[model samples]
Structure formats: structure tokens, C-alpha cells
Target: MNNAIKDKVIEILSSIKSGVDFANEDQIVTGGILDSIDITEFITALEEEFDIEIGMEYMENENFDSVDAICEMVEELQEA
Candidate 1:
């Protein structure tokens, strides 16, 4: 399930920009893989894909920093 989420996340990231190795690049926001526009698009994609709402409380750098972190957040949300 985690791998599936990661794969989906990678797919979404690729939609924003191609040829970027998201598997290795953990610092997605810091590394500038996702800019403001991309993050906006990412948020929409995430909400739709995960069927969860990312409230303001979950909007943090730690949550969006890496694919693993995002997957963990999605899992946590699902569990809740």
C-alpha cells in the first residue's frame, strides 16, 4: 500500500515536471522540485487520489518534504 501511494505520488510529481528522480530526491519542496504552482496542483492531486482533506494543520514542510513522509501522512489520515 505504501509502495502504491509512493508510485501514485511519483506519478503526480511527474505530471508537474518530468525527468526528475523523485525516488532519490527527498527534499522535494526544498530542492525546488515543486514550486508554489506545483504544490497547489499537488495538493489537489493528493486530495483526489487519497480521498482525504489536507487541512491547514497538516500543511507543513515535514509532511510534504519527501514521498515517504507524504505516504506516512496519507496512511495516518486513512487510519484516523
Candidate 2:
């Protein structure tokens, strides 16, 4: 995974919900670190930060579960 993407993702997530170790937390969605509203805000932030639109197809818990997963999704979207 890209370190830059990972760092940006962590920053974005932290902005939405503070005091959570996004880098080490693998169950962000399942563990309830972010709610529905936070997820919406996060997606918006990610779109602006990465210049990529996160469509409904990409809105899944597995996609946002961890920093690595988020980086992977961002990389995939960037490639597209």
C-alpha cells in the first residue's frame, strides 16, 4: 500500500473521529468507530483529498475497515 495514501486516509479519518488509532485498527467499520454520518463526511473528504469520486459501489464496510484497505481503495480508484 502507498504510505502517502495511508497517511492521508488516517488524517481524514482522524479528523472525523479523534483518538482512534486508524493505522492499527482493522475493524473501524465493524467496531463502530465511524457512524453513517461520519462515513458520509469521510467519503466527501476523501473525494476532495484524492480527487476521486467514491461511488455507491465503493461504499462498503470492507473497503473502509482499515488504513490499508482504505489505501488500497484509493489506489484502485486513482488507477481508474
Candidate 3:
């Protein structure tokens, strides 16, 4: 995974109640590593840092669910 994306995940995970030791993709998202507020804040930070706009379709948890998922999304947007 990209260092930037990984770092961002760690940043968001730091704020959550559960420990942010994501061993797998499902654990991070379904395990409640991030909530709605965290999502909004993360999107804002992502937009600012990566210079990409997260459209409505990309806002869903399925896309931004985990650190890996969000990293993939960022890579896709950056590639585009």
C-alpha cells in the first residue's frame, strides 16, 4: 500500500475508540474502526492531501470502508 494512504489510515484510526490495529480489510471497516463523523473528516483530509474530489458514489462504506479500501480509492482517483 502507498505510504500516504497508509499514513492517513493510521491517522483516522488513532481517533477511534477501538484500537487501530487492522490486520485485515474486513476488520477495519466492520470492526468499527471508523464511524460517520470519522468518514467525513477523513474525506476532507483526503481531498486536501491528495487533491482529489470524492464524489457521492465514492462516499459509501463499501468504497471507503477500510484503510486498504480507502487506499485503493485514493489510488484510483489519483490515477484518473
Candidate 4:
């Protein structure tokens, strides 16, 4: 994973979960890995992390659906 993606994921997780360790890339961030509320917080964090404006279209299951998926979407958006 890209450094920016990893950093952003870590940043987002930090805002949502104080004590949780997000340094491990394999650490899940969805489906029992984190709560729904945390997901919302993660989305917000991503918006700020990448310094890009995200719309509803990017917030769907195809993008902000999971940690890996979200990282991919962020990288794509950054590239674009």
C-alpha cells in the first residue's frame, strides 16, 4: 500500500479509535474490525487526510466500503 494511503488510514483510525493499533496493515477496519460510527468518522478523516472533496458517489459501497477498498479509492482520487 502507498504511504499516503497507509498514513491516511492510520489518521482516520486514530480519530475514531483512540487506543486501537492501526500500524498493522492487515488489521481490519470493517466487519467486526470497527463499528459503524467509526466508519463515519473514518470517512470524514479521509476527506481531510487526502485534502480532496469527496461526494456521495465516493461514499458508496464501491469505495468507502472497506479499509482496503477505501485506500484504493483514495489513491485513485489522488491520482485523478
Candidate 5:
């Protein structure tokens, strides 16, 4: 995973909801750290930050579950 992307993802996740250790939390979606509205906001933020459109196909719980997962998704999108 890219450290820069991971850092930015953590920053974005923090902006959405503070006080959560995004880096260590592997169950962000399954654990309920972010709700439906927050997920919507997070997707928007991610799209704006990474300059990549997160289509419905990429809107999976596993895609946003952890910092690594988020970084992986962003990197994949960026590469595309």
C-alpha cells in the first residue's frame, strides 16, 4: 500500500469522523464507524481528493473498511 495514499485516506476519514484510529481499524464499515450519510460524504471527499470517480461498482463495504483497503482502491482508481 502507498503511504501517501494511506495518509491522505486517514486524513479524509478523520475529517469525516474524528477520534477513530482509521489506520488500525479494519472494520470501519462493518463496525459502524461510518453511517450511510457519512459514507456518502466520505465517497464525495475521496472522489474530490483523489480526482477519481468512485462508481457504484466500487462502492463496497470492503473497499472502505480500512486505511489499507481505501488506499488500495484509490491506487487502483488512480492507476486506471
Candidate 6:
């Protein structure tokens, strides 16, 4: 996995929600760390930070589950 992308995603997630260790690639959604509002803000933050548009097809639980998945998705989108 790309460390740079993962780190940035962790940073974004941490900034959105405090007191949660985002370094373990934790399942934010399943763990109840990210609520509906947090998820919405998170989507905006990620789009702004990465400078990429997340299409509706890319909006899925698995894609937003962990930092690693998010990074992978970013990389894939970048490559595309």
C-alpha cells in the first residue's frame, strides 16, 4: 500500500473525528466511528484533499471502510 496516501487519509479522518485511532486501518463505518454527518463531511474533505471527484459508483461501504481502501481507491482514480 502507498504510505503517503494512507497517511493523508488517516490525517483527514482524524481531523474529522477525534479520539479514534485511525492508524490501525480500522473499519470506521462498522465501528460506528463515522456517523452520517461525519461521512458526508469526510466525502467532501477527501474530494478537496485529493482533488478528485468521487463518482456515485465509487461510493460504497467497502471503499470507505478503512484508510487502506480509501488510499487504493484514490490511487486507482488518479491512475484513471
lDDT of each residue in 1-80, candidate 1, tens digit only: 57888899889988888998887888988877788788889999999999988889987877887888888998988888
Q: Compared to the true structure, candidate 1 yields what TM-score?
A: 0.91
Q: Estimate, for each residue in 1-80, the C-alpha lDDT of model 2 and write its tens digit.
A: 78888888999999899999898999999899998899999999999999998999998999989889899999999999
- Residue 66 in candidate 6, Cα distance off native in Å: 0.9
Q: What are the root-mean-square deviations of the candidates from the true structure over C-alphas?
A: 1.2, 0.6, 2.4, 3.2, 0.7, 1.2
Q: Give lDDT tens digits, candidate 6, residues 29-73.
A: 877789879988998998898888889999888888888788889
Which regions of candidate 5 fall more than 4 Å away from where they truly are?
none
In order of listing, the candidates' clash counts read 0, 0, 0, 0, 0, 0
- Local accuracy of candidate 3 as per-residue lDDT tens digits, 1-80: 78867786667556543565553556544556677877777778788878999999886767766677778888999999
Report the lDDT tens digits of candidate 4 across residue range 15-73.
77777565653434334566667767676777776876677777564454455766788
TM-score of each: 0.91, 0.96, 0.73, 0.61, 0.96, 0.90
TM-score of 6: 0.90
Off by over 4 Å in 1: none
In model 2, the runs with Cα more than 4 Å from the true position are: none
Error at 26, model 6, angstroms: 3.2
What would the TM-score be for candidate 2 when compared with the true structure? 0.96
| Cand. 5 Cα-lDDT | 0.91
Q: Higher-TM-score candidate among 2 and 5?
A: 2
Pick out the ten consecutive residues of candidate 4 with the lowest summed lDDT: 24-33
Q: Give every collision pair in model 3.
A: none
**In model 1, where is the ten-residue run with the lowest total lDDT?**
30-39
TM-score of 5: 0.96
List model 5 lDDT by residue over 7-77, tens digit each. Answer: 88899899989999888999999999999899999999989988999999998999988888888888999
Q: Clashing residue pairs, candidate 2? A: none
Number of the top lDDT candidate: 2
Query: What ranking emerges by TM-score with the best candidate at the front?
Result: 2, 5, 1, 6, 3, 4
